[model samples]
Structures are given as C-alpha cells and as structure tokens.
Target: MPTPAPSASTPPPAPPATGAAPPGLPPGPPRTPPAPPSRARRLAAPVATLAGVAAAFAYVGTVDPNEPGHYPVCPLLRFTGILCPGCGGLRSAHAFARGDLVTALGCNALAVAGYAVFAVVMAVWLVRAVRGTPSRVTVRPVWWWVLGAVLALFTIVRNLPVGSALAP
Candidate 1:
C-alpha cells in the first residue's frame, strides 16, 4: 500500500530529544544543566591565590635575597657556573616587592616579565570569578614550543659574553 503525503505548508517539529528508549529498553532520566556556582564559591580560589602570592611577596620583601645566608645559591650556578633562567628570581621578587622596578628588571628581566604576565592573568581571573564565569587558560601547543624555545635562547644567550647584560 502507498502512504499518503501531507501538504507542505509548515515543516514538522523536531521530536523531543530526551526520554525516548529503544523497544526493549527502559526510559532514562531527563537531562539538565548543572547550576552555576555561588558567588563566594566562585571567588574563593582566585582570592586565596592572590592572598598567597601577596604573602610570598611580603616575605620576600622582608628577607633580602642579597644577603647570602638568607637564601640558597642556585645549584646550577654553584655547580656548573651556568646561569639558569631563574637564577635571580628571588632577588627579582624582593626588588619588585620593594617597588624598585629598575633593580627588579636588572636582577632578572625574564622573571619581571613573568611577574607582569602573572599580574595581568590574575586580574582577569579575579574579574571573571566575580562575574560568576570560570576562568580557563588555554595555550596552543605551538605557543608552548615557542615559549620553550624562547627560554632556551634566553638561557643560552645569558651565558655568552655577548649577552652579559642578560645575565643575573
């Protein structure tokens, strides 16, 4: 027998996409979106993270890394006499906390750049957290490789006489 076709005035609505089951199967529960987190819940992590960072800076500011006995010498510097990317990070942080931007950059320009990037990211994260949106950091693999290459270059150049300015 031939089936009769309906007149094409209005299109058919899509069937409800939930709660249907195969002939022998039981129906499953309906789908729902999870509720967004509460304001305090959303803010907690960003706030705590900022507080911890602030505390660290405060401690670094109080304790001078220039005083040899206060901080440990970089193992790479001590053993191999090679300056790593993070050779003067603590001293940089100490200078930064004391509001000596020039000295901070002089101590470790890369670390100072990192501090600026961290500040910008944390500010954005705090704003997003307050607005009840989750903050996510997504870097492409290519960018990661580029960053690694940049670091390697920094490490290499800092050790060379031509890049003595970059050395800590």
Candidate 2:
C-alpha cells in the first residue's frame, strides 16, 4: 500500500485581540509612527557631520590663532577684567598643534579635556559612518547641571591668588 500526502486545507491561526485600551482613558495617538528614513539621507548626515568636524580641526590646525592679531579678541576679555574658561582655548589649540602638551594644558586644561573628548567622539562617529549605523547623543539634565557647576567652580578657582596655577 502507498502512503497518502497531507491535505493543504488547514485554516490560518487567529491574531490576538490588541485593539482594546484601558477603560479609564480615551483612545490616543500611536506611540510610534510607521514611516522610516531613507538609506541615503541616513548615511549623508553622519558623513556631513564628520566632514564638518574635520574641516574645523583643519582650520584650527592651519591658522595660528595664538598669534597676537590673528584672531579677534574675546568680548568677555575686552569688557570685563575677568577671564572666561574659553579665553585661552585658541592658544591651547595652537600649542597642541605644535606638539607642546604642557603649554596646551597650561593654556586651558578644560579645552584639552574637551579636545580629547571630541577626538574620541569623532573616532566613534567615523566608525559608525563607515558601518552605516545611526548615532545618538543624549545627556541627562542632572549631568548638564553638574557640568555647569563644575565650570563655575573652575572659573572661581582660576581667579583666586592661590589658584593662579590654574590660570593661563
């Protein structure tokens, strides 16, 4: 005797009921939208951002902003007797370009830290760019407040006679 083939008459399974909402609230908009980004735009934005950063670094590296008259004076330094955290940033970058790490740090340790952070971020950005991945950067409000407090403290300490070492 020969075996028979199975029938193809099986019915499709029913989908679970997911349309109902909680009783207390009215129906609301969808939590997420259906539309998705195009591949070209997704790749273009990261590439543009990376290129912009490279251009900025290149400009800074080429132009000797440390020169007395090369760059415009800071408005804060012009009007106020106090120095801002960014006052020596240009000089610091210049020192960095010249491979003088100590002078760069002395000019603006905060700027040096920022440079290092930016370099690391750019490295990750380039990797993501090549891998065709999306990038997202988010900082908590508490972190922003903490950063502000730290800058304020740095500003105060740099001005004190005892903290002259912190000054540029």
Candidate 3:
C-alpha cells in the first residue's frame, strides 16, 4: 500500500479567497456558553413524572388489589396458579404509601427496593437538572442480563413452596 503525502503548513486553507474578513476580529459574535433551560423546559419532565407517580399512587391507594374486579389480575397467577415477583406490587405500594411497612413487606419486598432505587435515581436527576447538567443513565448490557436473570429466578423461586417467604 502507498503512504499518503503530507501537505505544506506555510499557509492555512483560505476561507473562500473571494470575501474579506469583517471589520472587527471576525464577522460572528463572540461564542458564548450554551444557555440553560428556560422556565418551561426545566420543569416539564419533573412535573410530568411527579404527576404520573401521584396518579399511580392514588389509583393503587384507593382501589383494593385483593378484589378481583378492581385491578387486572396477573396472568401468571390466573392461569398458572403461581405468584410472580411482581405480584402484590400494587398492594405493596399502597401499603407503603399508607405507612404500613409490615403489610408492604408481606406484599413484595423487591417492589419496595425498586421504589427506593427509583427515588434515588430521581433525586440524582433533579440535582443534575438544577445544576444545568445533562441527565444520563448508563447500564452495561451484562448488568441488564444479570438483572433479568435475577428477576426470573426470583419469580420462579417465589412461586415454589420451598420459597414460601418469597411469595406474596
């Protein structure tokens, strides 16, 4: 293979060769750092998330999950007669929101952990937003797979008689 030739450094590439440079240092205004969010954009996502969480909490809070008609039953429970890891999560959240820790744990321990994790993540998000920094979340693919496997195993084990404590 042939090597590329180096160019002369004496003269920098001409802008167009036809137009003259403007009166001051250059034509354009002095480059400024990017502006932070305006009032509306800054509050939008957080407000929406808060509203959604409030709505979810309200729905779960008012409606009893034990009743058949009030909430959609989990298909796994209905058809397979087995409890999934997500089972009783609504009841758990309702109990949690109502300040009943024992009931919440009886419902689903993992769901409580999820709520705490979500709170932490949202706190980070809010801090970043206030600081005018971009909010970002990055998880490795391996972590994703591991999380999936863990949830699957938890679901399977929770349904078994041997792991009755894990059951909702």
The whole-model lDDT of each prediction reads 0.90, 0.78, 0.81
For residues 29-71, write the lDDT of model 1, one tens digit per residue. Answer: 6677788889999889989999999999999999999987998
TM-score of 3: 0.77
Give the Cα error of residue 69 in candidate 3, in Å: 1.1
Judging by lDDT against the true structure, name the best candidate. Answer: 1
Better of 1 and 3 by TM-score: 1
Candidate order by lDDT, decreasing, is 1, 3, 2
Taking the tens digit of each residue's C-alpha lDDT, what string does model 3 give over 65-95? 7676888888989998988889989889889
Assess every candidate by TM-score: 0.80, 0.68, 0.77
lDDT digits (tens) for residues 1-168 of candidate 2? 986665688555554335535777765544555565666656676678768866876677789886777789989778886778887888888788778899999988989998898888877876776666777878899999988998888888887898787788
Tell me the TM-score of model 2: 0.68
Query: Clash number for every model?
Result: 0, 0, 0
Off by over 4 Å in 3: 1-34
Clashes of 2: 0
Ranked by TM-score from best down, the candidates are 1, 3, 2
